[model samples]
Target: MTEQPPPATRTQAQRTAATQAKVLDATVDALVELGYAGTTTQEVNRRAGVSRGALLHHFPTREALVVAAVSHLVDRRLVELLTRPRTGHEDIEIIVEAFSGPLFDAALELWVAARTDHGLREAMIPLEQRVTDALAAGCADLFGDRYTPAELELTVELARGLAVSRILRTADADRALVTRLLPVWKELLDRHD
Candidate 1:
C-alpha cells in the first residue's frame, strides 16, 4: 500500500487572514441584521464561528472590530462598483439603487451609532472619507466626463439622503417621483457635457 503524504497545512498568516475575514464578514452581517446597538462581540464571534480568543486576538476591542468591518465592507463595495458592467446611459435609479442598497444599510447602522459615540465617530470619519473618495473615483471612471464633480457629488448626496429617509421609515422612496426626476436628471447631465 502506498503511504499518503501528510496533508498540506495552512500557514499561520493564511489562518490569521481567514479568521479575520470570517470575523469581518460576520460583523457586517450582524450590523445588517441587528444594528449597532445589537451587534455585540459575542454575537459576532458566534456568527463567525470563531472562538472569543480568536476574535480578541484579531480585534482587541469592539470598536476595533466595528471599524475594521466597515473598512472591509467599503473596500469590497468599491471593488464591486469599479468592476461592475456599466452601460453608457444607465438610468439614475440604477445608480441610486447601487449606492443605497443593503451595503449602505449596514453602514447606516454604524453611522447612527457614531452620532453619539465619540470613539466610533472618530473611527467612522476616516472610513467615511475613504468611502467618499472611492465613490468619487468610481463615478469618474464609470461616467467619464458625463457629469462634473459637483454634479456627481450632488447625486451621491441625494441618494444618501433618500437612503437615510428610507432607513428611518420616513420616506417610501416613491418610484413615481424617481421616474419623473430621471429624465430631468439625465437632461442636466447632458447639458453639463
Candidate 2:
C-alpha cells in the first residue's frame, strides 16, 4: 500500500524551517559581504527573499539576528575544531592551526565589529564562551589526565589572547606568530605532561 502524505500542519512546519534556514544563510552572506555593522535588516530580508515582516517575525531584532549568526558561526567552528586530524600527530600545532585558520578569520571579523558595535559584542560574548570551552575541553581530552583543570583553563586563555592579538594586529602580521606562540604554550603543557 502507498504511504499517506504528511499532514498540512507538517508542511507548514517544513516551510517555516526552510524560511528560517534561508534567513540564516542570508545573514551570513550579508555578514561576509557587508560586515556585521554594515548588515541591515532590509538587506538580509532582500537576500533571504523574505518580507521585512517575516524577518522580524523570525528574528525580531537586528540584535537577535546578529546573535543567531554568531552562534551559527561558532557551532560550525567547534565541529571543525574537534574533528581536525592531529597535525604532525602534534596536538599543539593542530590546536594552533585551528585557531589560525577559518576560526581566526571568523573571530577577526567579529572582533572588529564587536569593538565599535556594542550590539554585536553583546550578542557575541556567550557564543565566544562556548567556543572557548570547546577548545579547552579538546585540549584536556588531548592531554588526558596529565593536565590539571587550572592549567587547561590557562592554556585556553592564552590561546584566546593570541587569537585576539592576531585579530587586532596593525602591521607586521605573519603566520609564524601563531606557530611561535605555540611552543611557549607547549612548554606549559609539557611541564604538566
Candidate 3:
C-alpha cells in the first residue's frame, strides 16, 4: 500500500494571520448582527469559536479589535472598488451597490456608535473619509464625461440615504423598490444630457 503524505503545516506567521482574519470576520459579523454596544470581545470570541487567550493575544481590547476590523474592511472595499473591471454599468448602479451590503450595515452600526463614543468617533473619521474619497474618485472616473461633479455628489448622497433606509426596511419589497428606483434615478441624470 502507498504511504499517505503528511498534511502541510502552517508557519507561525501564517497561523497568526489566519487567527487574525477569523477574529476580524467575527468582529464584523458581530457588529452587523448586534451593533456596537453588543459586540463584545467575549461575543467575538464566541462567534469565532476561538479561546479567550487566543482572542486576547490577537486583540487585547474591544476598541482595538473594532478599529482593526473596520480598517480591514475599508481596505478590502477600496481594493474592490479600484480593481473592479469596467463593465460600463451606470454610475448610480455602481454607487448604490457599493453602499448596500453587509459592510454597509456594519459601518452604519459603527457610525451610530461613534456618534456617542468619543474614542470610536476619533478612530472612524479617517476611515469614513477614506471611503467617501474613494467613492468620489470612483464616480469621477466612471462618469466624469457624462455627469457633472455636483451631480455625482448628489447621486452619492442619495445612494447613502437609500442605503441607510435599508436598516429599517421590510426586506424583499424594499429591496425591489430600491432596484426599481435605480432606473428612475438614472433617467433623471439622462434628462440633463
Candidate 4:
C-alpha cells in the first residue's frame, strides 16, 4: 500500500492557542515566585519563550493576561481537586496542603493586587465567581450523598478558612498544629453532616 501522508502541520489557530497557554503558564509562575507586582508581561514573555508581540496579540493588556492566567490556574486546580484520589479518611493537614499550595499562593497574589487595583479587581470578579462555582461543584463531588448542599458548602468554607489563614500568616499552619486541630475541625464538620 502507498504510504500515508505525514500528519498535517499544526494550524495557525493551534499554534496561537499553544502560545497563549505558554504565556498564561508563565504568568502563573511569575505570580507564584514574584508576587503580583513583579509579574510583568516582559517577565512572562521571557519565561514562556514567546515574543512580546505574540503575547500582546493574545492578550492586549497586562490585566487581560493576568485575568486569563488566574482563570486558567483556578480551572486547572479545580480539576485536580475534583479528580484527586481520596482515601475517605483525609484530615485537616491533607486538606490544608491541598488548598495552600503553589496555586493558592499565586491566587493570593492576584487577590491582594485586585483589592487595590480597580482594573484588576474588575477583571478578577468574574474569575473569582467561576472559581467559587467550581469549588462548590468539587465539594459536592467529593462528599456525594453523605452530606447536604449546606453541609458541603460549610465544608468548603471551613477548608477555605483554614487555607486562607495559613496564606495570610494569621494562623500557625505547622504540621503539628494542623494535626492537633484537624480532629476538632472534623468533629465540627461531622456535626454539620
Candidate 5:
C-alpha cells in the first residue's frame, strides 16, 4: 500500500471548541454530583484534563463557564421536551403530563443549585423563562380562544409547583394518590372561565 500523508491536526478554533465543550460537560457532571456551590472551575478543568489557563482562556470567568454549563444542560432538556409525543389532552393536563419524570427531576436539580449559587441564578433565570414561554405557547396552541392570559400563567405556575412537589415528595407520596388526583388539575383551567 502506498504511504499516506499524516492526518492533519485539528485547527486552533476546533481545539478550543472541543476544550470548551469538555469543560462544560465536566462542570455539569460536577454540579450533578456536588451541586452548583460545590463545583469549581479548577475541579472542572481537572476533570476535563484541560489546563486552568485553557479553561479561563475559553470562558474568561467562572461565571461564564457556569452559565455555559447551565445553558448546555437546559438545551438538552428543551430538546427532549420539544420532541416528546403529545397525547392531545387539554392544555392544563398536557402541561402537567409534559413536565413529569426526568424533565421534572432535572428542573428540580437545577433550581436547587440556583438557590445557593449566584452564578446559577444569573444563568438559570433567563433559561427557565424561555422554557416557561415555550410551554405557554404550546398551551395557547392547544387551548386556543378558551385559554386566557391569566389562566395560562396560573397553569404554568401550577405545573412548576406540581413538578416541584413530585420531586420533593417522591419518596413519601403514594403513586396511586397522584394518579387519582391528576384529574383535579383540570379544575384550574375550568376556573379560568
Candidate 6:
C-alpha cells in the first residue's frame, strides 16, 4: 500500500473536553430518564460509553459527576440563550421558552432530590447560585432596556416557576398554568412598553 499521512491529532485539552462532554451529556440523559437515585456512575459510564477509569479520572464520586452534569446542562442552555440572534421584541417568549427543555427536567430532578440529601444539597447550592448568577447576567446583557432589573429578575423567577409547574402537565397540549400565563405576561409587558 502507498504511504499514508499521519492522522491529525487533537490537543489534550480537546480530548479532555470531549470525554467530559460525553460523560456529562450522558449523566443529564440519565437524570432526565432515571431521576437522581437511578443516575449512578455505572449508568453514566455505560451511557457515555466510556471506561470506568475515564469517568473516575474526571469525577471521583457520583455527587461530583451529577453536579458537573447539572452545571454542564445549564451552561449549554446559557450559551444558546446568550448567543442566539434576537429581534427587538420576543424577549419574554425567548426567556420563558428557553427554560422549557431538558435542562428544566434534569434540574427539577436534582432540586427534588437535594431537599433531603444533605450531601447532594451541599454540592448543589453553589451550582444553583452559579447558574442563577449566570442567567441573571446573561438576561441583563441579551435583553437590555426591554426590562428593568426588577422586571428581569421577576421574569426569570416567573420562567423558573413555569418550568417547575410544567411537571403537572398531562398531555403535550395540556397547557400548564404557566404556559397559559406566559402569553398574558407577554401581553402585559407589551402594553407597558
Q: Model 4, residue 93: displacement in angstroms?
A: 6.4
Residue lDDT tens for model 6, 30-66: 9999999899999998999999999999999888999
Question: What TM-score would each prediction reach against the true structure?
Answer: 0.87, 0.72, 0.83, 0.84, 0.71, 0.88
RMSD of each: 2.5, 4.4, 2.5, 3.3, 3.7, 2.3
Range of the 10 consecutive residues with the lowest summed lDDT in candidate 4: 89-98
RMSD of 3: 2.5
Per-candidate local distance difference test: 0.82, 0.72, 0.84, 0.78, 0.71, 0.85
- Model 5 over residues 1-193: C-alpha lDDT tens digits? 9999999999989987788789888887776676556678878978999988888888887667766776676567656655677666544656766666544544566678778877767777887778778776666767787878777787778667776676446544746655766668666557656
Give the worst 10-residue stretch by lDDT in candidate 3: 86-95
> Which residue runs of candidate 5 sit more than 4 Å off their true CA positions?
1-13, 85-123, 141-146, 171-174, 190-193
Residue pairs that clash (backbone atoms under 3 angstroms), model 6: none
* Global fold similarity of model 6 (TM-score): 0.88
lDDT of 1 at 68: 94
The TM-score measured for candidate 2 stands at: 0.72
Ranking by TM-score: 6, 1, 4, 3, 2, 5
lDDT (Cα, tens digit) per residue for candidate 4, span 25-134: 99999998999999999999999999988899989998999889977877787677667788995443444555676778887788889889999999888888887787
Model 2, global lDDT:
0.72
For residues 1-193, write the lDDT of model 1, one tens digit per residue: 9999999999999999999999999999999899998889999989999999999989998888988998887788777766778777654565587656557878888888889999988888888898888878878877777778898888888878766766545344556566677778778867854
Candidate 4 segments whose C-alpha is farther than 4 A from its true place: 1-8, 86-98, 167-173
lDDT tens digits, residue span 1-193, model 3 = 9999999999999999999999999999999889889999999999998999999998887777898897788778767876888777646777887786668888888888888888888888887788778888877787777987788888888888888987777889777988789879989988987
lDDT winner, 2 or 6: 6
Judged by whole-model lDDT over C-alpha atoms, candidate 3 comes out at: 0.84
Give the candidate number with the greatest lDDT.
6
The deviation in Å at residue 162 for candidate 2 is 2.4
